[model samples]
Target: MDDRRLTDWMEGYVRAWNSNDPADIQALFTEDAVYLTEPYAEPWQGRNAIVRGWLEIKDEPGQTTFRWEPLAVEGDLHLVQGRTEYRIDPPRSYRNLWAIRLDGDGRCFEFTEWWMKEPLPE
Candidate 1:
């Protein structure tokens, strides 16, 4: 997909993240989508499961800030490099890479997130 399409999807994703609304989360993916929180971990398959899984570990609204830039695009696959910084006390941060595959309808059919925590200060 193109940068604009991916950006729109990313915006929707962040909006969903902030809202923790099932409909918002559900809209970002397709019916048969597969969502992998890590490369080698079990996936939340299908829209219903994805919604449930996301809610189970949902982060509170305004709990974090996120920024991202496009990394690459190969046909339907898009990659993004991002940073997430939590706003709570004893703050935390992470670097992220998201590999997203979208269907013709512009909804993600497969999404895998790779992330690493930043080392805390002494």
Candidate 2:
């Protein structure tokens, strides 16, 4: 994908996360997409499953802040590194690495992420 397309997609991802809207989430993926929350876990397959899985762990709208930068793009795959900050009682942050593969229509067919919680300061 081109840089503009990638930027638009990432922005949409952040919007979808904050909105937690089922339609927003569904719009990002294909009907038979696969979403892997972690490397070792079973992926949430298909749009319906993906929507259900996302809602199960859904964050409240406007509860988190996210920043992401494109790392690379090769063929249909796009790699990105991101940081997410949660504004809870005790704030928390996570660093994320994502590998996303987009179909011809710009919907993701496969997505995987590795997220690490930031250690508290001493």
Candidate 3:
């Protein structure tokens, strides 16, 4: 995908996260997509399962903010570095790296994310 399309996709992803709407989540992936929360874990396979898994850990709407930058793109694979801040009583943040593979239709078929908690500022 081109830079503009990637940017638009990421923007939609953030919007979907904030919306927490099932339809929104479903639109991001292909029917047989696989979503991995970590490197070795079993992926949430298929759109139905991905949607279910997402809801299981659903973030409250407008409760989190994300900033992401595209690192590289090779063929259908796109790499990104992102930071997420959860607005809560005790705010939390994470450093995230994502490898996403988009299908011809621009829907992700494989998505993997590696994340670590960000240390609180002194």
Candidate 4:
């Protein structure tokens, strides 16, 4: 996988996420995709499920956005460190580490997200 292309794809993902359009987000993945969330959270498999998962959260009563900070790239994997902030009613956030793996076609195959529900500073 081309690292530069993967970076671009990641950027497009953030853009799509900010759009709050699940279809846009889902378009970034392959037909058979796997998204693994933190412990206890069910993983989303396949494009259809992934699209549904994103749609369910798009209209949530919060201003949420994700920012990806690339940590490193090794082969087809990208180690990213990022945070997601959501202002539901009161401001809150989840700081996370994302391990994203892309296939040779620059399509995302695996997305492993690990985050903690933490209080926003007063």
Pairs in steric clash, model 3? none
**Order of models, best TM-score first:** 1, 2, 3, 4
TM-score, every prediction = 0.95, 0.95, 0.94, 0.82
Q: lDDT per residue, candidate 2, 8-84, as tens digits?
A: 77877888898889899999999999999987889999999999999999999988999888899998899999999
lDDT against the true structure, per candidate, is 0.94, 0.90, 0.89, 0.79
CA lDDT, candidate 4, residue 102: 88
lDDT tens per residue, model 4, 22-104: 66787788999998866678899998888888777664533787776778888878988878888677877888888888888
lDDT of 3 by residue, 1-122 (tens): 35765776787799889888889899999999999998688899999999899999999998988999899999889999999999997899999999999877788999999999988877
Clashes of each: 0, 0, 0, 0
Give lDDT: candidate 3, residue 81.
96
Q: Which of the two candidates, 2 or 4, achieves a greater lDDT against the reference?
A: 2
User: What is the Å distance of residue 52 in model 1 from its true position?
Assistant: 0.4
Model 3 regions more than 4 Å off: none
* Candidate 1 lDDT, 3-22, residue by residue in tens: 77798899999999999999
lDDT, model 2, position 10: 83
* lDDT (C-alpha) at residue 103 in model 4: 87
Q: Best-fitting candidate, measured by lDDT? A: 1
Better of 3 and 4 by TM-score: 3
